[model samples]
Every structure is written in structure tokens, then in C-alpha cells.
Target: EPEALDPRLRAPDLVDRELSVGLPDAATRRALLERLLADVPRAGDVDLGAVAARTPGFVVADLAAVRREAAVSAALRGAGSDPSEQVRQSDLLDAVGSVRPISLSGGGTLGSGGLTLDDVGDMTEVKAALTEAVLWPLRHPDSFARLGVDAPRGVLLYGPPGGGKTFLLRALAGSGDLNVFAVKGAELLDKYVGESERAVRELFRRAGEAAPALIFLDEVDALAPRRGGSTDAGVADRVVAALLTELDGATPLREVVVVGATNRPELIDPAMLRPGRLERLVFVPPPDAAARADILRAAGRDVPLADDVDLDALASELDGYSAADCAALLREAALTAMRESLDAGEVTAAHLATARRAVRASLDPAQVAELEAYARRRSDG
Candidate 1:
């Protein structure tokens, strides 16, 4: 489960009151908890609440399970139900508590919509460029650096929204045995001034220890928002500081790769763009014909379609659709077919035409013209 965004996610230094302990046998549970606490608690730490406060890494889920089982037991007793079935002795969860170790400050997963770089069918030049600039170096960090030394520390994958940049990042790291630390900026902030900073320090420290790691930070704007002239001083600032230190610091984890993704790269701190920081920046644009066809095949190869579903014409019409958009359109068509099948009879050629007619190109004609003009303008430059 995700870390609770509320105050529950942050543990306080002290406990507020004595809460009732619920277990199969209170005597054994209390005894075990006291034993664990007694090993670490200072003098005058006599209360159960105090003991709990002292306990680190005590999972709330386990405690909830105990309380739930106890409630079930009580209800069964009132109903004269079978004690064994109501709440078995094994229902009590173990209360083994230990200090939770810290981890990296900024790492999080991109959306796992299965849109890999492979799923992106077109833009061979874009794909090749990204590979040579980012993946090739990552594969042979020392050789690419040409110094028999460390590789690029971090890579920033930034592009337009719905461009499948994040999807590419996930495809690059979803598997293949890389230790990934994913942090969501929206979820990592703490009101306590240094809590987020501490977490950040711990996160990088852990990543170094677990080298050959991938740190993926999504929606980095929350941490590295454009440092304006007059922004409020808060925990966000500390998180930003911690982020810089981790990214730029001379860590021994030579194989560690940091990947930060955002739709609005302009909103990020300018300093991060420097080489050896987020030295590599790859821009993922919308799909071309090859990519659109691949995305459609990947999305709807399994779905039964009529012979009249013109893949070429569909691809031509979907000039500006990203891999994500292509998949969405395919799903929309499939859903329409499913509904039509249930509502009437089998889906036919006319149904596919109906679906295609209903589905509109995401980009306006003006935007397409502008993009073409911009690409050409850059060529002139």
C-alpha cells in the first residue's frame, strides 16, 4: 500500500496516550512488546504508549489486523459461535519491531501503461538518438566516458505531455535486474522542516549501498520548481536542497543512474541542466507512422476487427497521436465493438468505420502546421 499522505505517515517523537493492546492473548503480546521496548527504552519509559513510541518500523497494518481479529472474536462470543472459526489462536500477528532504515530522497516510477520504447513504433531517429545518448552510455558507462571512469550521474527525460517519455523510462527500467528507488514528489513532503531532507539523504545513501541502481523521480516540479524571487520558505525548499546535494554530490556509486521526468522541463532549476548533473536530456516527441502502427498492433492485435479497419489510413490520420494516444484510440474502438456486440449482433466493417469516424485526431490542424514549421525552423538554424 502507498504511504498514507496524512499525518499518519509521519511518526511523532512521543506517544499521546495509553491505547488498549489487542491480541490473541494480551499477556503474551504485552510481554513481547515490553521485551522489545525494554531492550531500547530509557529509564521512566513505563507506559505501553511510551513503549510503542519507542518502537520503530512498527507496521500499522499488522496492528490493525490484530484489532480486527479481536473484534471478530468478541462478536462471535456474543453470538455463541465456534471459537475456533471465529478467531483462531494463529490470528494474532507477530509484533517484531525494528528500526526502519532510510532510503533515497527522490525516486518514483513512471506510469506502467506498458508503453515501452519498443511500443513506440515510429521515430527511428528519435529512438536511435535516445539510445546512443542515454542507453548506450548507461550500458558502457566507463567506455562511453572514455576515461575508464564514472558515467553520467543523472538523465532527464523531458518532453510534451502525452509524448510517452515516462513510458519509455519505465520500459528501460521495469525489469532486467536494476535496483529502482521511485519517489513521488506529491507524497514525499513533510511539514516538519528537515524530515523530507533526512529521507532524501537516507535514500541516496541506500542507493549507493545498492549500486547499479535506478532512481526515478516523477513530477519533479514539486521539488525543483523554478526557484522564483519570492517563494514561501517551507519543507519544499529543504527537499530541493537535499535533491541538489544527492544529484551533484561525489558519490562512489559509479553505476547509479538518476532519471527525473517532467512534462515542463522549463520549470526545473537551471543548474540541473549542467553536464555531469542531469547531463543527458532526451526529448520524446509524438509517434510517426511506424510507431502508430506498432502501438495499434500492440493495443488491438488481440481484439477482433473487421477487414475494413484500414490500418494505413488510420495511421495517416493519427499523425500527431503519441504511443499513449494511439493505444487509447484502439481501446476506445474495441470498447465500442464490445458494446455494439452486446447491444445488437456481431461487430462488422460498418462498426469499425463508425468507431474510426467517432475517434478524432488529438492535435488540431494549426498545431500540426506549427510543429512542422518549428522542426523546419530548427533545421534552418
Candidate 2:
């Protein structure tokens, strides 16, 4: 935060120019690592490119520190005199883990896990829209350029609570091995003046350093609610302005994609939904019987089900269950089976029936209807 800086320094009339040095990109980081390792005794298996790709928020100095740490480890093991103790890929990776980059201190992580869109339960259209809006630009940049079109800047996912908006984002983060900066909107709120906007700026800065990144703002309504309607002394309004600035500001988003999820889309600032901002609004609806079955099967992949535990039949019985509710039902059923017998091997029909009585659907019918109405209004507009 620039809390310590004099406000006069920020005055355009007083300051003529300002220069900002950002964290190193993947290629620059690789080159820096190569230079640092040029004279060091290292194993042939050490791949700097892989290291560079994995270290998203690392700066040039961070790379140097990693090399220094690795060298220290190698020297402690008598690396200079013994070839067997030479710096290896593991040594550098271990060093990378030991050093924390300043850019990453703001909070974000490099994408990980093996989940893909296929793991999600039967949201074919949602998956397709996410693929086109988020993954295509990073995967097929040339195609976009050839067509003389810029990629989508962002996407908004809104639906009833527990309706799988966040689940879809998890699938997206794993789809392309891109960096992901995940943060809940409410986490950015600060009681101190200017702190919230600084946090917002810091988040985008970290995301930009990690290019081809996805900024997942879960519960984004808290961060960018309808402007001029807050009683918090204009803090929410300022946050909305900051978000608008970041969305279509002078500094282009480049390879970064912003995705926001909220249960209350109607509460979001209208300006945020404008073209070139979070323009692609995708409504995640409650799962139908087939989708509920898919969710049950996916959730119960590890849990053994008895011959009588028909997932399709159970799904049909669950009329208002959200994706999360379906998953919870299976979990509760497993717990019920465990309660019935400590040595129980499989969940039975009776266990599921008992579990259903406990884990009722959480979705509010009126809220769902209101969101559906909001979606219709956006679509018609």
C-alpha cells in the first residue's frame, strides 16, 4: 500500500513522470535463472524453463535468491569437490519453495490439480462458454488475431447459492494449467481508507505478472455492488469505481481473464456488466434429475454403493437439490451407513433414505426465481 507516500507526490501537477518495474515474466525469469546457473555446477536434468513456468510471481531478485539458496545447499553437501553432490533439479525446486516472492505475498497461487471440465457434472453449455471465453485466448491466440478480434476480458457467473458457480471456476483453473488468482470479494474490503482500492490494485498487479491467468473473484457482489446505494460512507462506491478502472483501464488486461461469481447478480454494479468488462454473464441453474444423477455418481466415485442404491432413482426423488446438496447427500449417506455398522462396506438404499431426511435442499425458491428473472432481463437487454 502507498499509505506512507505523501499525497502531494501523487499530484500530476507536481510529479512529471513515474516508472514502475513489475515482476519478471516466464521468458525473462527463465533467462535470469539460466544466467544465475551459468557458472554453478548443476545436473543436466535441471530444467530452468519448468522452474520459470512454475514460479509465477517471482521477480528477478527472487530468481537470484533461489540460485543462492540452491548453491548454499549444494555447498553444504560438498558439491564443489563431489560430482555426486552437485546441484540438481530437486535442489533448485527445493530452493524455489524456500524463497517467497513479494508479488505472491498479496495472495494467489499457480494453477494446479488434475481436474478438467469433464469432472464437472453435465453442464455442457456452461463448460463450452467457459472454454471459449477463458481458455481459447490463452490456447489459440493466433486464431483470435487472425480473426481481428480481441478476446473476452471477463465472465460473470451468477446463480442461487450452492448452484456450482464456484465449482465451474475450479474446473476452469485446472483446464489449461494457467495461473489462477483466487480471492473472495469480501476479503478485499478494508476499514482503513484507500486500503481496499490498494488491495484491488495489488491483486490485478500480481495477476498481470502471472500472464495467461484467471482472476477468480468469488462472491463479487460484495466488492462491486450497485454504486451510490451503500451507507458505508462511499467505500463500496469507491470499490466499484476501482473495479471499473481495472476492467477497462489504460493498462490493458492482455492475457488475463477476470471471472466473478455471485449468487446475487442483481446487486452487482450495472457498469461491471458493460461490454469489455465482465460481459459474458453465465447463469448456473439448479441441476435437473439427470445432472443430479451425474453429480451423485461423481461425488460417490469412491464410496461403495449397494445394489439397491440407484443413483438415478435417488436423483429423481431430489426435486430442489443443488449440485452441492447432491454431493452432501452422498456424504451423509456414507456417514449413515458408517453409523449403522462400523464395518459397513457399502451405502444402501435405507442409508440414503435416512440421509435425505437430514440433508434437505438449501436453495431458496424465491431467490432462484429472482436470479432467473435477472438473467432474462440481461438476455433481453
Best by lDDT: 2
Candidate 2 lDDT tens digits, 198-292: 77877787688667788999999999999888898998889888888998955777788999999988889989999999999998888889989
Per-candidate count of clashing residue pairs (backbone under 3 Å): 12, 0
Q: Model-by-model lDDT, in order?
A: 0.57, 0.84
When superposed on Cα atoms, how far off is each prediction in RMSD? 12.9, 4.5
Off by more than 4 A, model 2: 1-21, 32-55, 58-102, 108-119, 174-176
lDDT of 1 by residue, 343-369 (tens): 543345566556766666674556545
Q: Give the TM-score of candidate 2.
A: 0.80
In angstroms, the error of model 1 at 196 is: 2.4
**What TM-score, over all chains together, does every model reach?**
0.61, 0.80
